[model samples]
Target: MNRPVRTGTDPDEARARILEVAEQHFRRIGYHKTPVADIASELGMSPANVYRFFPSRDAINESICGRVLNEVAEIALAIACTNAPAVEKLDQLLTALHQHNKMTLVKEKHMHDLIAAATQENWSIIKAHTERTVTIFEAIIRAGIEAGEFEVEDAAEAARAVRSAFMQFFHPVLIEHCVQHSEDIEADLRDQIRFILKALRKRGSLEHHRQDQDSQPIHG
Candidate 1:
């Protein structure tokens, strides 16, 4: 006997389609406004079927916002790979981080919904992002210490201090700050970077400060 071909779709592919539709809906209508039915309708699938893939509208929302977070991670990864001078890298990182956090994640609809989304589910994707950022800061701190550029006692502690400059990179805190002062987001981000850098330079030498003008790695 000959066997017939299967016509049914894969569960994973169907799930991805549902999430894709939900993401667009969320961006256009905000999380509260976009219901499960709306996502099902947009995906041309039954609401129950969509539910089968994602347990609820909230789950779908997490996947949606998580996708955006992944995009931000992609940008950070690309920047982290560049071997530019630490000062130039620092400048590039701050500018990119501020604009991405402010423009892509915060300003987009889901706003607070996105923060809630992050809390509701696994955040392995964003975890990878923070790790990457920390690695970059650690490398710079060690480089500075070796080059006699910075006089820090511990590179690991200094790296953590530098990482603190990016509180906005974490979703929940970012949303809360944005909600309180959406108007002054840029100022807040810049001030945060400035404060962290100042703290990082704790007892560091002045001869080789981290400056784009110098174009030199701060080596001990």
Candidate 2:
């Protein structure tokens, strides 16, 4: 005879299953409206049993949102590898930023309401992920400058520029503006990508380098 499934399955397995179910629930119904019982029913467990595995609903929500954000950042960093052209990487970064933030809203709306909680309790995860993205782009910028394809000064600052541009693109207030005006953010982003890259490149620095090289005495 087939047996009934049990609660508190391996902790890791149970958490993963909970997150998978929560993603759908949060997407279908906003976070506040998605009760622990709803997720438990979907997973074929009693509400108390689910709680044994996850102490609180907000905790479960944070785990699922963190997982999705990491996946999106990994994909963006992979496509931003040095083998890709700067322009190509820029476009990938912009696309990833837009899609990631959009999905982040849908998946973790509760986290927004609980921002103070997360900032106090979970800020390290946030800082670590942001640092990871900055480091990845810094590597790409340094590589491009060495290759002579890009004339960039201060890879650190350049990385920050890319990060800041994306920040603006994904800013919540600006997102509301975009929704209200129905502006084509994608089209605007493409235009802004060029401006971002141009600003990052060492404009006058490159010209000065060229002048110095031309002035060098020939050693025949």
Candidate 3:
């Protein structure tokens, strides 16, 4: 006789299994359509049992979304940990992030939809991811400043500005809009990066220009 399957009594294992099944369902049939019952059924458990692990479907979505964001964060962390100069690291990091996101949209349409929805809803996971990414940017900026590549007074503020300026390339909704409109996203991203680099370098020049003006005798 075949042995009966068990859902297992370990809470952590149960939660992990739930997330794995839910992610599979989300990728296959889309998260919006994959009810909690379906996930429980797939695990040979009752919906109420699934609820014991995750309070609600949204909570499950948040966990899955967090997992996806963690992948992107890992990419950023890898680029940051490289020995390249700060300027080059920042450029490569931004390009890699953009390419990864665009690839996801093209190759993982269902997963992309889930992320887009999470972004639109302003999920806490999204905010946490953004903060983590900004922290990475801030570290890069600080390194660049130390290396005399960037001349910003506040690395944190500059990092936030960089994130804001690059939102078009990073934000899922904006990226999708660009694709739908057939915009030259690659060209635009390059232009934007160049513009940001220029801004970082120009701050020092502007400061010197003001000092030069201050040193000159004022005409009475």
Best by TM-score: 3
**Global Cα lDDT for candidate 3:** 0.83
Instruction: Please give the lDDT score at residue 135 for candidate 1.
Output: 73
| lDDT of candidate 2 at residue 35, scale 0 to 100 | 86
Best by lDDT: 3
lDDT of 2 by residue, 1-220 (tens): 2112354357777777777777777666656678887787877778887777777876776776566558767787778764766544665676667655655545555543333244346655566767887887787777778766567668888888888876656654455355446566655655566567666655654455335434543221
lDDT of each: 0.61, 0.64, 0.83
Model 2 TM-score, 2 decimals: 0.71
Please, what are the lDDT tens digits per residue for candidate 1 over residues 2-100?
Answer: 111121557777777777666777777787787787766666666776777778666776677667766766776677568765544555666576566
Candidate 1 minimal-lDDT segment of 10 residues: 1-10
Give lDDT for model 1: 0.61
| Displacement of the residue 78 alpha carbon in candidate 1, Å | 1.3
Q: Superposing all C-alpha atoms, what RMSD in Å does each candidate have to the true structure? A: 7.0, 9.4, 9.6
